[model samples]
Target: MTTTLRDAHGEALSTTDRSALAAYDHALDLFNGFRMDPVAVLAPVLERDPGFVSGQLLMAGMLLGSFDGQLFGMAKACVDAAAASLQKANERERSLLAAFGAWSNGDALRANQLLGRHLIDHPRDLLALQLAHLGDLFLGHSFMLRDRVARSLARWNADDKGYGYVLGMHAFGLEECNEYARAESVGRRACELQPHDSWAVHAVAHVCEMQGRVDDGIRWLKSTQRHWATDCGMAVHNHWHLALMQMASGDMDAALKLYDEAVAPAPEAIALNLNDASALLWRFQLRGVDVSGRWKALAARWRLQAAWGCSAFNDVHAVMALAAAGDEDASRAGMAAIAEAARLHGAHAWAVALPAGHGLQAFLAGQYARCAELLLPLLAASSPLGGSHAQRDLLHLTAIEAASRAGDRALVRAMGDERAARRLVGARPARTEDHVAA
Candidate 1:
């Protein structure tokens, strides 16, 4: 007779092997904390028990969340493997497998909707909630980011094992939706509950960055370095935030030092890490900093990912590196690829990817008027590009810089006014050096 095992939330696990269940719980803990690589942690367990559907689904959700096109095949295989165990899985597992299947099939919208429905039935499913929250993040659905967690909050309390993680997610959502004060409060509470929660630390960092608290942002991240900087998967990004604060403080030397020691240090093939490198270097480019060697090295790594056109956000960043390095042929090739991807993928590719890519191209080529023309229109509707508001601010920063270089003072002032309006009342005013420091 098979014994029923339940996860931390009391949800039934399909496997009777207590060891597999424990491994699954451990992997879930790693994933929730953004610490170790959960996929690696579960690989051996899945090899030992092929019928562990929950483990398979967890792996699939993680791979899908990576946003790396190279991992899509693995994600699909995980979905297929889980489907083979469908006869043993509960309804919740089946729903999760179906959602992963949709994501692997390139229907992220469908996958998110499926997860939303699954949550309605199983609000205590922390794994499902995490996958759904990530889907909202990748889809740039700000309201859903806040509301998805909001809808499930009543089912969770401080005593729940992953309650702090849930608050961390909600805090990020609130920040994205521009509720800075509440986001900071909730995020700090999450850190207090789980001191090593890097996501919670990141959420509060974002709040500080957005509110123009450069000194406070630096202090917050530095004070919490012990929690997030050691063996944490998100360390590079957190370092990138610190570098951004240094940039805001007009210490380009400090920012460059952070880039060399903390942010990149070496070329990375991962799209997520590459995005951070390119965004940081591109900021230097906008400031007329001489980092051509860094650009060339970063562009070389980006060239290895030439086949990854699934994410428009990634494609635009690739264009940034290639263009800044003065690799005209590669830059043109990157733009053409975006155009082809747009033609194949429709509205999002066309509206977000193509313009973003070409706008960066123009900006790098000193065609400032053309760059502003291409990117300014995207300011209001670039969420479809898929990234946090802070990440997407690259486009806004570029547009403002382009307008300034083109002698469009009205456009510059208008963009500045828009930025100032979004900032909290006590935040620093938009400085000329922030955008036009040459």
Candidate 2:
């Protein structure tokens, strides 16, 4: 008789080693819980049974998800290790490894397709669904974000252990696709089901940001603060959202305070943490606040990060920090890295990002008209940059500020009209007339 262990979704493991199975299950529990330490839990499982294909695939997925250039090597190693054990794995496990292989090899579209196919065959494969959701996020495929989760959600229910997580992911998808009301409702429902579901909390935050509901965002984040702030992997990002809400509510003091207390003081200055710091400080600069030392701190971390330049999205944020810090040498190096990366791995995404990065760098250099000229036309079609609408709005804000500084009344009005039409700038300084005066 083969001893088997099951995942949270009641899927049987391919490994007959009871310890490896238990470790694999433990790893999944950690992942679903958003502990962000699944790799640590899964490491022992892979060691105990070197042929544990499921464990290998899980490790690979987590490594790819890290969004760290250093980890790409690790992710590729996991893919290679799993190749020898492919025959021992199930069909689903084999497909999972294939997706990992593509993603590690810099073919995100193919990875997403493989994950999509795997989900179609096994909608109950929560791991595949989650990986696909992340892949869609990287590809900036907003429709796929919502639809991929929706397609699999029919197979899930409240009775499922990680149902809240699935709902949270779906809510983010819906939020990205502009279904604000429904996204908020579903996100709240997810938080109700599991208060510790940080992704769900973030989904609601995204809705609030998009809808310009500052008070609602603040209240929602505060009310659910403990769940995410204490143990969630996305604690800093959640704080970043709260800071945005604070800034929107005209509370820059509180927002900057949060940055000092929670956001920038990250244990490890990864791209995620550094991006939040750079973005928040940039927003402050736009609002005419002096973030003198903040840019220097952020730029330091980015100097290390710029060496790899694996993703164009990360490259843009790094340039923002370096440019703001007025580190001409680092900025030049970072820009060169971005150009090289785009030239080497230039997809539709990098094409948009490359000019956007140049525009941001130009803005920091006080070349306002140049910034406006570069960013204005590309504003509408900038989705391939692979960030949330809120994150991408930084580009729009930069364009507006650049236009304003250049005293380009026509450009300011054009950008302002778009914001006003969307009700994104009601009677605020971003209003056309006020911005034109600046």
Candidate 3:
């Protein structure tokens, strides 16, 4: 690791000096540690390597991965750097990276366009095919993602790896459509194509979680996360997800430990801080955990801006925290920002989220009747317009709590009858280590 690879006379490396290298490594380490904002840690490196900004892409990825998109400003300049890097790379790689950058920055349309262009040239660019599939996944463009995967499957003669990507993506898509069996099968095939792939793992998690197979979700989480933990950045993200899972299973203390690890560091504006820290708080509040102090500290630096859709997501989570903590003024402020950046797609996005948020606030306030009223509509909508496993689980869980408190038999019956019947399943031919060497 110490030996120079680029040259002998040029300090044996890139970025002009070791200071920049140290900065980059520090940022990367923090990134791997907790998905915290890499922008803070990366600042020193960016200052030194202004001309070389490909590093910004990682910062954006950390942001996007966490679903807290308010840290885009810190990485805005880096987007240009990344774009420049893409231009400098080979046409195919550039196109793929460009699509990735767009997706990371919360612009699926741009990602779709870039992937589209790349597909025109290489028709079977595996990277483009995957990016296109993902762009559609997040953009509420299910048909587009499905169709692209279909074309890729046909064009590539259904290569197993490519099929894995398509099926993995479709696993989530089917989950969205309440086609749990289809979701499960596709997800399992994706895992078979390349065991240890994160998407494949996620698909499997969905299949298990939706079927109420907690043990299965736990096994998938354990194996997949144990492997990811070797890398600090990936492990950090894993912890974030793990925290949520633990809390979902009523392990608040365990979740808290994970949360502490997720955001114990000094605050930064980069990807690692933004994602890991912000997301930790959001999930805490979502789980009905009192994260008031975290919210206050986080809100101080949280501004509303659309640099990479970070502002919207961050603000939304912050709003949830404030509302739950009973800070009306602060909560309203947070909601104002979130309203603009709210995710609106699928038949139940607004119906589900709006009510769920209200019910959460009410639950926090001990207003069970209001909670039931608000959550009932969402529970009703969710079965028909399903979503990602975690998302749908959240919808049902909130409703369960609300209805149980309110003594609403109809709500209980609806969820049990409509949602429980639908289950997603996924599997792989065999377990393979080192398959996700990203």
Q: 320-419, model 1: which lDDT tens digit per residue?
A: 8888888888888988888887888788634688988888888878899999999988988989888888888888888877888888878887886886
User: Candidate 1, which segments miss by more than 4 Å at Cα?
Assistant: 1-3, 265-269, 424-438
Clashes per candidate, residues 3 or more apart or on different chains = 0, 0, 22
For candidate 3, give the lDDT of residue 342.
49
Lowest lDDT 10-mer window, candidate 2? 423-432
lDDT against the true structure, per candidate, is 0.83, 0.80, 0.51
* Candidate 3 global CA lDDT score: 0.51
Residue 256 displacement (Å), model 2: 0.8
**How do all the candidates rank in terms of lDDT, highest first?**
1, 2, 3
By TM-score rank, best first, the candidates go: 1, 2, 3
* Model 3: per-residue Cα lDDT at residue 250: 64
